[model samples]
Target: MGRNVLVVSTVDHADDTLRARIGDDVDEVRVVVPVVQQGFMDWLANDERAATHAEEEAARLEEELPAVSDARKGEADVLLAIQDALATFDADEIVVALRPDDETQFAERIAQEDLRPSVAGVPVRAVVIHEQG
Candidate 1:
């Protein structure tokens, strides 16, 4: 059977890289991002003080012609759902695409997760990509 590869990336740009590396070897490419949902919920479920703060920031950014905070609740939700999806999908291998500099730190975070050890038992590969100057 072909390898079921899980590609965990912090940014969507990694999708291109995954397509390149995954060429023929991987039968499927699943993306995992683990922060998107929690951040949005924490922002959305704000108490009076926090909501006011967010509104002020949003206004300030707009007045300054800065970018608006786009609603990425879905992305965040997907990120927070990583472990669950991993179990559900039964991926044979995990290919973590990280910047070379942050590769160690990212791996460390995964190792620290409660579910990581069991998941690690199934082959996990970390693919670090060097950044261009």
Candidate 2:
């Protein structure tokens, strides 16, 4: 029998082919998505004036968008969350399916961590799923 596998997804969308492959596996598979806080959602959906201002601010920081300290902290938090979620499941592997063009920081974070040891022996494979045209 196949071992359990967990899929961490930043987006709800997964292509049909990949989904089919996942379903074909005999082991259990679970998909986990990060929840956007209400405040963050509101910021994203702000009025035209606010949205423009926010965009301008972000653009201004493009040169140094993610400082090393901040990036490390975010990755650590994600690692902990992933650990907690996998705590109860008997997973033999973890497949992280992230969008190629996503602006979210999940992919970068996971790529920086040591998956095998962090997962307590469960092998982890990070797969970047680029959207098909």
Q: Cα lDDT of all candidates, in order? A: 0.44, 0.44
TM-score, predicted candidate 1 vs. hidden true structure: 0.48
Give lDDT for model 2: 0.44
Q: What is candidate 2's lDDT per residue for 1-133, written digit by digit as tens?
A: 6556665543324434335444554355544433221134343463344334333432332223221111111112335545765776666676655555454444334433444533676766666666555
Off by over 4 Å in 1: 36-82, 102-120
| Candidate 2, backbone clash total | 0
Over 60-80, each residue of candidate 1 has an lDDT whose tens digit, in order, gives: 322322111221111223233
